[model samples]
Target: MTKMNHKILLGAAITLASLQQASAVPFAPSDARSMGMGGTGVSSAEVASTVQFNPALLATTREDDHFGLKIPQFSLSVADDGGFIDEAEDFDEESELDTTGQGRTNVDLLSDLLDEATGPLGLEKMQQGIEELKAAQLLPNSAPIAKKTAYDNAATKLTQASEFLDTRLYSRNPSVNGEAGLVVYSGAIADDMDDLNNKALRINGGLNVAGAVPSKKFSMAVHAGAQVTFSGKVKIDPKDTDILRNYSAATSAYLLNIDALQLALTNLDENDSSTFDAVDTAQQAVDNFNYGGAGRPESEGNTAIFVDGELSPEAEDADLDSEIQMIGVAVADVGVTASRVFNIKGHDIAFGITPKLQKISIFDYTQELDSEEEFDSEDFSENQEDYSAFNIDLGAAYQFGAEKQWQAGLVIKNLIGDDYESAEYISSNGVGGAVVSISPMMRAGISHRTSWTKVAFDLDITENDPVAFEDPTQYAAIGGELNVWRIVQLRAGYRANLAGSDQDIMTAGIGISPGPVHLDIGVMANTSDIENEAGIALEFGVEF
Candidate 1:
């Protein structure tokens, strides 16, 4: 695992350094009202939040809503359907290694086995015993019991060492899989590697403040807010799987040599010259046993333990090129909005415009697998690229019906599109960077209103491109609101992806407005997987 993966898994609640989504759908930064109604606000937004959806709504608001002040509003969303985040968080807890004493890992086990097999009391000691037996053969007067004892000791040590290798490195247990029923594999480290293959995670957050004055003749508002996103994915090297899985096969070959040498020892005969030649052959085999040299593996049994002499591929410090890529962005904007209602042939039409200044900061970071260094959130800010630009938004709304209860609205945001490049990183493969794209997006909405009930629907007319690394999105949403004598309100809605890239979302919310002061809260989650996809918004304000 990389340091960035750890930082995101452990410090997610305390830091905003990393977040990700499976799809690149754009998120709205409006108040709880729009969120509760399935993000449908273009045609039915209140005066204080009209600038966030369709500015024309500022002038077309209810006749009694003379003034609106939304001091603070906040929203957050996250998606991780891949289960990457959960796997990372549970890595330590779910590890199969022993935790009672030294907490030995697979690398530690291999190192111990290698040292025992090649150390002073290992092959060298066995060779010394063989030399003693050869001396016994040379001296015809030597006691047969002593010679036999020497042979037994040498053979016993070889047998014990072979058994040790089997227990420690070649053991297996039963396991069941959905696709492949009951089967046995090398087990621990290889299984863990398979679980971590290719997975992604995402997170988003926003905050805003605004104030507006509503009027049919002329309406005005000021809005300011910021939206931040963090996301990443893991990319495992294919070589790691081969290295971990082939250990059993290599060790089995070594065990076979041990068995053959033992048979030659058991058939030893001092009187038979042919037997002498067999013993010599077995001794030669035992003495010439060799384990392959390490660096990068060239074949089976040649797992790369050390890379460039200092770092081990199995250790946390080894750099095996890029294994994970992450991106973070913050977009802040302040805007002044103006709108007016016009009357033509007994019909009411509203038009509005907003001009805003935007500051965008983006961070692109990458890290190799098995890295131990801690990832700092400040790195995102320190290495980010900053860009400043001016943008415009236009909106229009028309009201009709016998009691003027029907309304239709259209909004075009970010008329002047711009693209900014983020920081870059170089690896053995190539250079990589993130592009923060601002593009024009249009949405159309329609609504029907009564004294106590209002229903609205909205549809995206253009597909919006991702700002970082996500999928393009177009949405169709429907929502309804119920007012309880202007005191309490309940809202429910649903949103569907027209592009068929993401899951459908269900939304619900509540509002309290006894007099001039109001408080609202809204929440949303995908219909299928609530744990990986969810959102919440909250706001406090005054309206009349």
Candidate 2:
């Protein structure tokens, strides 16, 4: 157990501990009422919830007048399976170490240490060398000549170290010596590293407003809503870039320009260059850490650049912004819906249609981050593409049971089955472009009701393909709600993904209708092995 390796491990552990929270793809209801009943309302919605769940149900409402406004909502759903927090939790502190207690470390440890000048490897290596030289001066019984040589060499090393400490490479351009510098000892993302690195993030939010005119035979409503979905990963990839290349050369120049290290690196062996040597280039070298004459290759007059003075692979690469990929989509919908109730064969049936206009915007982006800061939002939107289109939604509900308390509802959304192309960007080098497909989904549901309690079930007949790399979803759910004198209601339900990728989602909600002002809140928990998750929702609206 050498004291040195222990310090290295401690430093590495601390560096690896810096992690950003992760976001993953999640499913949440658009409105609070549906959120409460297992994200269900296809056949069981009344009040203003009818606009979103099933427009046909608007004609069957028991309330005299209808209007709704939900100002804001926040839903934090957990999906840590591929998130940064999960990997940080499972990091193996001793995985890179050998059991023999040898003084060896992964040479690539320099990459992380290089990211910070004060890191263990660089500072410790320098200090260790100084200490070893000092110890040599204390040898006993040595020749006076040998002792004098040891003392002289040690004094010279200390002097040069002091000079380098005062150099501009360290004083002014601290970033390269800071977080921007890293020479990857490991190759591209490997399997072991992939496991340690994989993690994503997803955030979603929405707002809505609606009002309805109700009658026994016919009803009409106008619903407007806007939603946004943001998804990205917390992992950074190593790539070559023009910016880093210059930085690498600059760092190399400074390390080489230091008199102490230059004495060794620039010294010529028997076969030295015809003319150039440390003494020749020493005066011309700037303390910028880039001694290679504007970072040109060695053949281009950077003969003074070798050993410690040349550019590192980490410094030569560019575009720290290209490390992470993010995708965002915003959709605003305005729909005018109308429904009519019919009596056919002693049955009460209603049919509704909604013609809506949608403005779609998508930002498909990839950036190489130079530092840990965020991407510029204004710059991101500037490169986005948006479009507007019209669509139709058709719905039908039939009442049939011993007491007509049972209802069956069917909804066909985006009946046109349209395709949308989100914003697409390709670099001049043809290396970066992400094309995503925006598609459609259709669903249906049924529910039975009584004076105080109602039970419902819903299913998505079509697979809802995700735009990003997320999984497609096709699920079925069963839920129920109990009303106490139409004052406060308790609701619970469960849903399963028929697509085979999700868990049995358990849901519960509480609603307080207190007359015209209505408030409903719901929660959903993923109980199966599919990435551990839980979600919450809230909505408050007024109806006449």
TM-score of each: 0.76, 0.64
Each model's lDDT comes to 0.68, 0.56
* Candidate 1, superposed: residue stretches over 4 Å from native: 1-25, 95-160, 172-189, 257-322, 342-347, 425-430, 467-471
Per TM-score, the best of the predicted structures is 1
Over the stretch 1-544, how does candidate 1's per-residue lDDT look in tens digits?
1111122222221121122322232647657988899989889888788988998989988889999988788889887656666655544343344444665544343444445544545444544555664564454434545655566666676666555544544433313312110011234444544555555566778898999998889999999998887766665566555444554454454456667777876886645557656766776664454332354246644544322311133422223432656677788899999999988777789999999999987777665554555677786676677889999889999988888899999999888887666656322222366666777889999999998999999999998655443455688999999999978999999998877555689999999998999999999998888976789999999998
Which residue ranges in model 2 land beyond 4 Å of their true spot? Answer: 1-29, 63-78, 88-112, 115-193, 196-198, 234-322, 343-346, 371-374, 426-438, 500-502, 528-531
Full-model lDDT, candidate 2: 0.56
RMSD of 2: 11.5
| All candidates: CA RMSD (Å) | 6.9, 11.5
Q: Alpha carbon lDDT of residue 421, candidate 1?
A: 68
User: Weakest 10 consecutive residues, lDDT, candidate 1?
Assistant: 176-185
